[model samples]
Target: MPRELVDYRDSEEALRASEARLHEAQAVGRMGDWELDRDTGSMSWSPQLFRLFERSSALGTPDLNEALGYYSLESVELTRAAFWAAIDTGNRRELEQTVLLPSGAERYHATTIVPVKDGSGRVCKLYGTTQDITERKLAEQELRRKTYEIEDLYQNAPCGYYSLDANGLIIRINDTQLRWQGYEREEVVGRMHAAELFSPASRALFGQVFRTFKRMGVLHNMDMELLRKDGSILNVLMSSTAIFDAQGNFVASRTVLSDNTDRKQLELERTAHATRLADLSRHMVDVQENERRKFASALHDHTSPNLAALQLTLTNLARALPPAALPGLQPLLDDAQALLLDTTSGIRDICTNLRPATLDYAGLIPAVQDYAQQFRLRTGIEVHLDTADFTMQLPSNVQSLLFRIAQEALTNCAKHARARNIRIHLSNRDTRLVMRIADDGVGFDPHHLGEAGTTSPGIGLITMRERAEFAGGRFSLRSHPQSGTEIKVTFDVGRSGVLRPARRASDFANGTTLPTGTQ
Candidate 1:
């Protein structure tokens, strides 16, 4: 049925159709055929060949010399030798040459030459095909240039870059990383394991995480110490991403090592500076306490006794005066007694304010209690002291620190808080001596305080914090605009607070109840 349906009328028509199809295919490929006669140095070109050269039928097919004219100077000589070689050897040859077009542009042409022979076994004509491969050749050149640029960038980037195989061996590393570790590429890659590049401590951590990394596929900001070839250490932060193949199998990891030595050194210096500042603060607090104690001792021992002696003298003198003299002496005696009494009271207050006798005689708890009572009386604020579970014979300096911080905090509350009630808490809980002063008052933001210009409060908060920290304790203050304020200080007293024989809590702060058990 198929044979009957096909119609074939003329063989010549079929041949013409076939040749037309071939011409269309060649044109699409930008290829044309050529032939040259060795005998006459003449040439023949295909229909597409003429079009490729941008010549019309009027300008007949170019001869050997005419075709040679299209090539650039260098290519022409090479093409000529290739043609002569093909003719002499009776074999085929191919070469690429830059050909100049009539339109004043250049194009790369790939030309192939083959020698044809007669039945008499002699060279006759040359047959070959030429293709305009300008686009392909230009593309190849561009690709090579870009590849070189990418390789340069990878080698010279600032951060150290490296890749590791699935076995944790170094597969590739950049010049920057190699230089940092004092190693050439030949010594490290494929020879050193990733763990060998790090210090022993870092190696332990890296070993553990590297397992997890293989599974998790990502890790970030891992601080590690790198051991250089010269036995020195370099701190580095490592971050990496795992690579996977097309079938979702883990293949390798790409890692970046960032130099962190400068940051590490800065941290060390900061710690040392903080330690020095703390030492200085403690020294200053000691000197201040000593001065207060000396001043208070002078008033209590010397001045108070002198005033009492004078009062006694005045009373005895009145008793010894005569009846007529007694009238005038009585007024003088009364005025002298009143003046001395006032002066004595003034001196006692100055001594108490400078360094309270209770702080030295009764220890920190009793001193704090006495001061709290005074603070309540002076400010007309209701004060509550809760040391019901607290009793310890702490070092005198520790006692002083706690007392000063409480005093400063209470003073600030009275002056700025505008509150009605205050609660002072001293307790030993969880092996720590914790003291908290809380007030129901108009509060302010602590952050704005002690800033460049001003804040809602004064430097009292700063002083309190310094005192607490200088004594190796932690201090915290919490205050908001509408909320109340609380200052807490904790000293790590351990179970020793419970170990020592304790005094009654009421001896210090009158209102506080002594512990039922400790009492």
Candidate 2:
């Protein structure tokens, strides 16, 4: 072969190899190159450009006007302006354009335009590269949408969020917290300390605990009062997490605040309602006691006197008739006199039970002693009364309450316990007054009360408990089968509503135990 022919063949083969590599690179990158004749408006496109427009290569490259048709309506004018501007300024320009393909699908593209100038600096042709950027553009769009959603949620959440720097200055705060404190973002972000948001009292409390919280790294459900710009108070439950640096030193804190005003208001309302109910119950007890006293007084003054006079008149009539018909009428007089005496005794017993006059005159100790003696006589049960340690003089109502509780306990013992021995004890420890009544009897199960077909002693037990509670004392009962029954009532002598002291009860007692005689 001739030497010149061999060199030409080698050169042509190298050129073909370079063109093939260029085509492959364009295809892989989804990019294409094009050139436009400045004068004739003719255009030339690479093979990848044909694919990018979804057009057939057989048709060849179109003119500039025809090529612009491949772009979306909105992108057409923008692309034309860039081409013209490149020619006018003889400069390179880059733009993103939306392409409308033959298949009616839209694609995003990045185009770079360079103007070719001749020796006189007169632009002759324009060249540019277009890359299919659809996937990248879609990813960017999705990221922007998610960013917007996250920002919205952070700014408008139901609970307030704020962050403070290591120096306790408010560093970052969400919109919700700004609204809660009646502040603008600019007002609090860098100018105010976290503790400054609280009321004076709460500020002092927060100052005391905040240092501890920083070291602990977490805080939960701390109740706080926020002083708003409008001078109103907002109750809140605050929780916090501490942020630290690499060296394990505190750097910032993230805090959340939940509104607790409604719950606080509910608690206050419930307390007021309970107080009202207690007052009403105390008033009712007082009224009931007064009525019982009046009824007992009526029976003692009128009924007892009338029965005594009737017995005296019968005695006088018998004395007048005895001499004339002594033997025959003497038995009749004796029977009438016995009946009258028994009736008088029954009336006196009724009056005592209704309202023991000793309870009003001699206080609780003597009243309980007298009742216990009568209870022992009636039920054949041994009675033990111990008030050795009880030295406080209780309010009249408390004394009455304790006495009534003891009375009902004794009655239940007689009716249901079938007991043989009873002990009544009273004592005062510190500011508390305690009374206990116990019986050695066949006790029933406290839990199973009113469960079977038997008559439940629960009604009497309930009455005793109510009496104790209404007087602002605590009541408790203990009972078990084959064991015994015990009732305990405790009053807080320090509490005004529950109990109050005057002089010591020992002042009223004749001795350690009062005389157990009928009053």
Candidate 3:
């Protein structure tokens, strides 16, 4: 073959290879090219453009009017406006269009139109490039929708939210918090400090804790009160966490505030209810005691005197009887006198047990002494009194309450304690008065104690506790099987009534036989 013929063949092969590379590049980019004849108002499309629209290339390219039918109405108007603007100004413009394909599928395309000018700089023909960007466009729409939803949630969350800079200056705040404080967003962010949002006490605590928070990176469930625009307080539970930079420097903080009003009100109501209940119990105890006092007085003042009179009359009758009928009548008169004397003595004991008069007349010390003396004589149990570092006048009610407790304790000790020796100690401290009753006997579990006024074994321990507590005192019992039982009751005398110091009797420590002194 001649040299010219070989060179011609090589050039033809190079042109085909270049065209193959161009087609591969366009296919990879999902791009196609187009041009519009300015003078003839005609259009031309590349093979890739036809494929993107799901159409065959055998048919001639569509005109502007025919192509508009493939686009949605909104896209048609946008394309029309952009086309005319570019044609008149000789400028390049880009537009996105949604096109309906012949295969009944919808697709997105981004198109760029460049105007071609003539020698006189007048716009003539147009060259353009179109890309099949359906996948990218759908992805963008999904991302935009999700972004809007997240922004909405952040702005209108249930609890208050805010962000502060390292210096405690407010930087970002959500709409919910702005509404809570009755302030506009602009008024808080960039203008207010986080400390200014809290009440004075809460602010001080926040300042102290915030330093530690920046170091620890977290703080939670701190109680605080925020001041609203109207200067009203809003109790809230605040939690915070700090954000640090890569170098471990504090950068920002995010905080959440939840209202704690309901819980606070509930606590206050519970406290008030307990106070009312305590007062009612005390009143009922007082009413019961008053009735006992009146009944005891009636027996002492009237019944005792009447019984004495009957006995005296019976004695006189015996003395005045004649010598003739003296033997027969004397026996009957003696029986009547004996019965009257017994009735009188029973009435006196009843009055003393019902409500000891010494408790009201002398004081708690004398009243307890008298009861202890009677208890020892009646039960044949050794009783000891310990009154150390105490000498003062107590309120009548207190004296009565203590005496009753002593009575009940002694009765229990005699019946159940099987005790050989019992001890009673009374003392006064700064603002409290303490009394203890202990027994050297087989002790029982304190938890199994029975009703106060019941006929059960223990001496109305329940009754003793009720009396002590109703008088604003505390009651405690300590015991274990085989050890010993000790009862301790304390009264806040300084709070209950006048508690003054009395000059101590130096010789009062000398153990005396009488119950009035230590034994």
Candidate 4:
């Protein structure tokens, strides 16, 4: 072949290769190029443009007006406007357009138009590129929706949320907490310290714990009182997590607060109700004791004296009549005297049991001793009173309550505990009193008390417990089969009311020694 012919063929081959590369690039990018002839209003499209509109290459590129039909109604107007603007201004324009394909499917495209001007600066042609952006657009829409949802949840959740800086200043706070404290966002965030939100006592507590919290990085369920804008207090349970810097230094904190005002109020009201009930019970016990004293006094002063006088008059009459018929009537007089003496003795015993004068005159120790003596005489149970460590002056109600509990305990031991011995131990410290009545008996289950079809300790035990509790003392019973029964009552002597069970007493119950003064 001639050199010119060979050169021409080589140039044509190079141009064909360049066209092939352009075609491949457009397909990979999901982009197509198009041009509009300004004078003829005809349009030309790349092969990718054909695919973009779902049209076959055989149908050929459509005219300007026909091409506009591929876009929806709104997009058509926008496309026309963009074309004219590019022609008028000779500037490149970019916009996103919605394209309706031949298959009734919608797609998103980013369209850029660059006006091609001739040498005279007259806009003779318009060229543009449309890239398929449907996937990117859908992904962006989903991301925006999720962002809005998360923001909404953060701002409107039921519990209060806030963030604090290392300096303990309020850095970020949510709308829910703003409403709770009756403050606007501007007033709280960045303007106030975290301690300002709490009452004086709670603020002091928070300050003390915050330093430790920074080192630990976590705090859970701390009770706090918040001072609201209106000067009222709100109770909340607060939890916090610390955010740290790269160096492990504390940077900020994320805190959540749960409102427990209603729960706190309920607790206070419950405590008040319990206090009232205890007061009423104590009053009733005092009243019952007073009535017993009056009844015993009346029998002792009037009934006993009258019975003794009647006995003497009957004796004198017997002596006067026995002179005439001494031998026959003497036995009848003796029987009458014996009946009178038994009646007098029974009345005296009843009076002593009702309100023992020793109890009122000599206090609890003597009262317990006297009652124990009588209990031993009646039931043949050996009683031991241990008061070697007790040396406090108790309130009258406490003394009475202890005596009554001891009395009931001994009575129960006599009735149920087929025991040979009882030990009544009394001990006290500065303000605490402990009394334990233990019996060496065949013990029964304490838990089964009052249950049907079970051998119980009986109502006497319940009465003893009530009496102890009514006087502001704690009562406990420990027993098991073959282990013996022990009844314990503890009181706060200073308060003359109930005391919580001491740990030492529990230790002692488990067969360990109590502190120095108690058994």
Candidate 5:
């Protein structure tokens, strides 16, 4: 034979081998082949097909009825109808049905049937394959059940769940979060970034928090405010963790959000209540001081002058008496004068205590000077008042508050410190008024004085602090056992001064000029 003829023969043999291998491959894949002879009305099944029907090849070719009987009753009817329909219409059909094997085990098989027509256009045969698809069907059913479970959890979970991409874009959200925002899931998911759900100020804070989270891997209990679709803000306690890929690069984040609006509202309400209480306290102190001033004025104007006049009248009457009568009345007159003098002095002292007259007679400096003089005269403890750079004309209320604070400090020092010498310094600098009172006295522990059951109860100090705070000033006291005590108070000059910014020191100090409204 020639070379071409020999090559052609070899190719034909190779083609036959390939076809055989293809058939073997199909059988190995649990696919059974079948064919039908139209003229004989006989069906031929491969060995695997016979096994698929739970029968041996000893039964040989089966009739259509025999093949139908191998399927369940319902499957049998369905398959028979489909087979005949395909044969009559020349249409192909593929379907899955269950069959009972000889071992009584039920098996699922997928069958494909193709119709063949003869030269006369009459259906002659059907050929197709049947595959064992039981495992695939079971796996598909399991997957569908798990998918439903996951969806149910996402829809009904109590906490808000959300996922954001690396750019803070919202990728996924659960029904809980959508409901919180008064929105449907479709309204926001994949349509907005997480930052978009926040107010402008909150967005800036969120950006910083997000960067921190990215660097830290997780951020817990981050308090933030989120804006809803309706433009209302919600306080939320949120926690989130960054999701990373296998390579450890951040990909997205998962966040859990809880509504804390009620808690935030409660906190705001508490702050408001505190402010109201503080205001009430300040108003009470003002009222008390006004009452004291009224009482002090009445005592000075009505009581002290009456007592002095009574003493003078008694002295003139005693001098006019006879010598013998004078001796008898002298003791009485002397006692009357002493009592009158005592009454006048007591009234003056009470008046000063109620509202120091020096405060009105002179400026704060002269008032402090008079107080120091009186204190030293009474206690024999030397007190020095140093007032410089104190030219501002302060509001009367501020002046009263400062005076009361100084009075309280001096009284406390006298009673508790048992000091010999005291120094008070008042100055104005850098738009602020500063006052310091120091004593070379036996000092007690400030902490102990503030505590319960300690020597020298700190009621006076507490009162002083409250007074200073009411005046919009700061107060602090420093003292330790065997150490000298120091009390300092500072107030903003702009707030304390009654005069305008343009007022000069001479206008206030020299009394040459009055404030804008004063005569």
Candidate 6:
């Protein structure tokens, strides 16, 4: 053979090799190439194209019928119609469809058919590409389904939810949030943001939270105030998270808010009620103290003085009688003397009941001693009083309350205990004033006694507890049937003894117990 003929043969071999390599590359990419002859009504496909259609064999020249048989019935008809339409219109067509392989596995494909024309400007051949897009199509379908599900959740969520852009502009909001604000979706969507829903005072706070969330990625359970469209304030418990893009740049904020207005209102009302109850209790105590002072003053001033003058007159009359005549009149004198003594004693007892003079003149210890003496004299209970490790003068009110508590305890013991010795102890230790009253007599269960003025109608223990509490103290009592009773009260003397301004004489005359030295 000539050298030129040999060279031509080698170039032809090289072109064939290059075509084989192109086919190999298309197969690797999961793509197939095809060509059609319009006049001859014949088609040809690369090996990859035959494989994509799941054909077991590729004959000399394939026809449209062979390709249609590879597609599902529905897809075959649609694809055929679209192919003919593109051919007649001289336009390109792209389609996606599913076809069952010979092995019975379903495959997804994308086909793009392009028309080729002869010099006469008439269609003669068609070229096309097909790609196996099963993975990509399945992924796209899954993404669409998830998007719909998320939209449903946003529309029907129970709590309000919203998203705001970096500029605080409202980007999206849930239907629940719109309803809570008394607005329709069209009214506020993309038109307002977090700041728009905040009261003036809360706007600044909202800004601070937004900035913080942007840096921190999440803000949890923040309590905030919001202004509704109706110009009412709503309390909300809010939580938010900052959204970030693929590059980790802050994009927007997603927040969930729950209404707490009702709970907040209940808490506020409870606080107000507690404050009012405290004020009323103080007022009642003030009134009670005033009444006690007035009664005490009346007993000491008017009643006692009149009884003393009467005794003086009787004494003068008794002394003026002659010594011999005095014997005959001695019985009358003795009666008058006894009557005066009884009247004076009655006056003193009445005065003590209203306000014990020893409590005002001395202190708690002396007053308790005087109380024990009076109790012993009255009930023959053989009372004893003891004090230790105490030197400071207590506030007059504390002294008065302690003395009253002692008085009530002794009275209860006298009426109910029925048996023997009573002991009263007042001492100070570790900055606390401790008072204990114990009776060795018949005792009743302490728990069985209900509150003051309840079924028991007894205020002895209740009064002591109240007084102790008023003085920042704790009160406790222990007793059992026939086991005797013991009452103990402890007060932080230094804390409760802060001196308040003294009240006046008229205040005391109006039944108020003005501070003893305040006069």
- Model 6 TM: 0.52
User: Which regions of candidate 4 fall more than 4 Å away from where they truly are?
Assistant: 1-25, 54-60, 70-73, 100-106, 294-302, 315-334, 341-357, 447-455, 469-472, 494-519
lDDT of 2 by residue, 257-315 (tens): 99999988987776555556556767787787788889989878987788789889988
TM-score of each: 0.76, 0.85, 0.75, 0.85, 0.60, 0.52
Extract clashing residue pairs from model 6. 290-511, 290-512, 294-511
For 221-320, candidate 1 gives per-residue lDDT tens digits of: 8999999999899999999999988877778999998899898898777655555555566667778999999989987899899899998998888888
lDDT of each: 0.81, 0.84, 0.79, 0.84, 0.77, 0.75
Each model's RMSD to truth, in Å? 8.5, 7.5, 8.7, 4.9, 11.5, 11.8
Q: Which stretches of candidate 6 lie over 4 Å from their true place?
A: 1-279, 391-393, 428-432, 450-459, 469-473, 492-519
For model 5, where is the 10-residue window of minimal lDDT? 510-519
Q: Candidate 3: where are CA atoms >4 Å away?
A: 1-31, 35-51, 54-63, 99-108, 116-127, 132-151, 203-218, 243-252, 311-354, 377-429, 432-437, 445-477, 487-519
Better of 1 and 5 by lDDT: 1
Model 1 RMSD in angstroms? 8.5
In Å, residue 395's CA in model 6 sits off its true spot by: 2.5
Which digits, one per residue and each the tens of the lDDT, describe model 5 over residues 15-91? Answer: 98997887687777877888877566678777777766768778777887777777898889778777888888999
Candidate 3 local lDDT, 340-421, one digit each (tens):
8778867866877888787667777777788778777778888888887777567776677677788889888888888988
Lowest lDDT 10-residue stretch of candidate 4 = 508-517
Candidates ranked, most accurate by TM-score first: 4, 2, 1, 3, 5, 6
Give, for candidate 3, the lowest lDDT window spanning 10 residues.
510-519
Q: List the residue pairs that clash in candidate 3.
A: 452-463
Off by over 4 Å in 1: 1-9, 50-59, 100-104, 243-251, 265-331, 351-363, 380-384, 388-401, 416-421, 428-433, 440-484, 490-519
- Of the pair 2 and 3, which is ahead by TM-score? 2
Better of 1 and 3 by TM-score: 1
For candidate 5, the clash count comes to 0
What clash pairs does model 4 have? 472-497, 472-498
